[model samples]
Target chain A: MKTIKNGIFNENPTFVLMLGLCPTLAVTNTFEGAYVMGLCVLTVLLITNFIVSIIKKLIPENVKIPVYILLITTAVTALDLLLKQYVPALHETLGIYLPLIAVNCIVLGRALSVASVSSVGKSLLDAIGIGLGFTLSLSLLGLFREVLGANTITVMDGISSFTGYHAVFQVFPENSIIPMTIFQKPAGAFLTLGLFLAFFNYIKEKRGAAK
Target chain B: MSLFQLFITSMLTENIVLTKFLGICPFIGTSKKESGAIGMGISVTVVIVLSSIITYLLYNYVLVPTNTTYLKTLLFVLVIASTVQLLERIIKHHFKQLDHLLGIFLPLIATNCAVLGTTLLNVNNGYSFIEMIVFSLGSGLGFALVIYIFSTIRERMEFANIPKCFKGAPIALITASIMALVFSRFF
Candidate 1:
């Protein structure tokens, strides 16, 4: 429980650690892309952590970093092909980012810091915690970008052949200037993340003061 | 597209950092110091140019011939990581002054998304050898250009009053957003 909370709130990958900013910013233009990206990271994180734990003793010291990277690349490659087959649109949306996950510092950072040293079960727990934290942060950022930039909330828009494909909701009336189109652009991504980071810092200060 | 147009587009209009959102980690982390930004920028440019050449050859000659293109991501990253390591040693032994500037950043460049991202883009775009060289050179210089500009702004920002909560990364990010806005107009 503490591990999960630590991952989600304390060492949140996006807001706190500030690792993996590439995907966090690039894909958050839409809620769905960000959400899927988070889940993909979570999956890769879990797989890498699991295998690293099991093979920790067998690996040599000098070759550890490259070995860990190889493991991560393999996992990301498998996930990439699967996404390409099952969800072509989401795969297209993610584009280069899906493969870029292999290099995302958060995954390699955890593999070095926690997974390589901890027990298998503990590493798995940490993975879940950190993964959830990452997912939550990405989702929140995505939600903010989608709502403010486009004034819409999209959830599982076209995962299947269901009737009326999009589950999108309009937040503002048509032609309302309240929705800033800039939020969907790269600048908006930076601005939104900055505000979110600042908000988190303010909260942390307040809590520190209370303590 | 012509080589000159490709160069311009890669360097400015489709900047690797400002527009494509690659290498944000180093862009924010290393940009606080101007010298560090230059060091990182130059090192990244060298690595990007070198790795793009090797990866392009491997992709066309090796991966395509063998029908194992799926291995490009894994292979490209490995090639990049090894290339950075090799480049560091050569620089250390041969170019002392150059190494002093880029030594520290060389290791970091291996994991930089920008390096891998550019290599992948080259293959994905199917650029010819000369086009690949031009594109990578332009992209690297573009990265250097943006980081240098950002470092100068951040240098001045040292004196600017900022909220306590927004003192560090937040304010820099906001500043970058503004910079990004300005750069986006070039297209």
Candidate 2:
């Protein structure tokens, strides 16, 4: 329980650790893409952490980094293949980032920091914590970007041919200045993340003061 | 696409850092100081350009011939890791001063998405050998240019009165946001 809360709040991957910013910023233009990307990372993290913890003793001290890289790459490749086969649209949206997950610091970092040193159960819990933290941050950023940039919250989009996209909530009028279209672009990604970070920092500091 | 156009597109219009969001870790990590930024830029260019050539050749000659393109993510990362290690050694032996500046960032480059991302993009775009060289080199220069400018801006930002919560990464990101906004006009 503490581990989960720590991951979600105290050591949130995106807002706190700031690892894996590439996918965090790139796919976050839409809510669905961001969360999907987050889940993919979460899956990879869980796999790598579990495997690393299990085989920690077998891996030699000298060659651990390469071994970890190979492990992560294999997991990401498998995930990529699965996504390509089952959800081609999400795969298309993720593009290079799907493969790029192999290099995502969070996976390797967890393997190196947590899994390599800890018990299997502990490592898995840590993975869950970090993965959830990552997903939460990505989803928050995605929700903000989609709502402010496009003025529509995409509940489901390109998941399948039948349902299609449904923009659930309309916050501002279509032609109003309230919804800044710039939020949809690359620049908006940075700005939104920056502001979000500042907001989180403010909350953290406030809590610290109370303590 | 023509060589000049490709160069411009990679460097400015679709920058690896500001636009593509690749290498944001280092972009934020190393840009705290101007000198560190320069060191990181040069080191990244050396690695990206060198690894680009090797990965391109390996992909076409080896991976394609063997029908094992699926191993690209694994193989390319190994190649990049080796390149960074090799470059670190060479710099240490021949150019001690340069090594001092770049020594810390060298290991980090192996995991930098820009190096791997640019290599994968080259293959994805199906660029010829010359085009691959131009694109990777341009991307490296673009990474260097943006980081240098950002470092300078950040150096000045030290004097500015910033909010308590928005001191470090937040402000830098916001600044990059503005930079991205400007760079988007290139399109």
Candidate 3:
């Protein structure tokens, strides 16, 4: 429970650690896209942590980085192909990002930092915690961007075909008011991220003062 | 697209850093100083060109023949990591000044998404040999150009008054956001 809280709040990947900024910025243009990307990262993180922990003892100290890279790339590639086959829409939305996950820093960072030194059970717990942290941050960022930029929040779409339903919630009717179109652009991503980082910093400072 | 157009497009209109957002980690982390940013950019340019050519050949010959395109990610990353390591050693022995300039950034280039992203984009786009060369060159130049400009601005920003909370990364990112807005106008 502490591990999970540490990942989700104390060491939040997006706000605190800032490990995987590229995907966080890229996919958060839409709620659904960001949600899927977060879930994908979570899956990759969990599996990679589990396997790296199991093989940590076997890997030689000299070749650890390269070995970890190989493991991560393999996992990312397998996940990429699996998504392509089963969830083609999400796959298309992710595009090159799916492949780029091989170097997402967060995944490899955990493998090196936590999994390599910890027991399998501990690593798995850490992975779950970090994954949840990343997912929540990504989703929140996406929600802000999508709501402000497009006045709508997309929870699910074509993926619903598999489950026989579609989901989208419009915050305001079309033409109701001018949406801040900037929130949908690359610039908006940076601005939104910067603001959130500042907000988190302010909170941390306040808590420290109280302490 | 013509070779010239492709070069300009990749370098300016579709910049790997500002537009595509492939290598923001190094762009932010290393762009604090002008000299370091230049060193990092040149090192990344060298790695991207070398790795792209090598990965392209491997993809075409080894992966294609074996019907294992799925392994491209694994193989390309390995090639990139080894290439960075080899380049570091060769530079350390042969070019002391260059090695000193690049310092630790040479090895970090192996993990920079821009390097792998360029190679993968080349393969996925089915670029001809000449086109691949031009694209890689353009992408590297684009990265160098953006980081160079950004670092210069950041150096000046040191003297300017910034808010307490936005002193470091927040200001840098806001600057990047404005730059992205400016760069987007070109396209």
- Chain B TM per candidate, please? 0.97, 0.97, 0.97
Spell out the clash pairs found in candidate 1: none
Cα lDDT tens digits, model 3, A7-118, are 9998899888888888998889999888888888889999999999999999999999888888888889989988888778878888888889899999999999999999
Tens digit of lDDT per residue, candidate 1, span B1-187?
9999999999988888877899999999999999999999999999999999999999999999999999999999999999999999999999999988888899999999999999999999999999999999999999999999999999998999889999989999999898888888633
Interface RMSD of each: 0.5, 0.6, 0.9
Local accuracy of candidate 1 as per-residue lDDT tens digits, A57-85: 99999999999999999999999998888
Per-model TM-score versus the true fold:
0.97, 0.96, 0.97
User: What ordering of candidates by lDDT runs from best to worst?
Assistant: 1, 2, 3
DockQ of candidate 3 compared with the true complex: 0.79
CAPRI quality level assigned to candidate 1 from its DockQ score: high
Q: Could you give the CAPRI-style class of model 2?
A: high
For residues B1-187, what per-residue lDDT tens digits would candidate 2 score against the true structure? 8999999989998899988999999999889899999989998998999999999999999999999998898899999999999988998999988878989999989999999999999998899999999999999999999999999999999999999999999999999999998887734
Give the per-residue lDDT of model 3 (tens digit) for B39-85: 98898899999999999999999999999999898998889989998
Question: On a 0 to 100 scale, what is the lDDT of residue A113 in model 3?
Answer: 97
Best by lDDT: 1
- Using TM-score, rank the candidates from best to worst: 1, 3, 2
lDDT of 3 at A200: 80
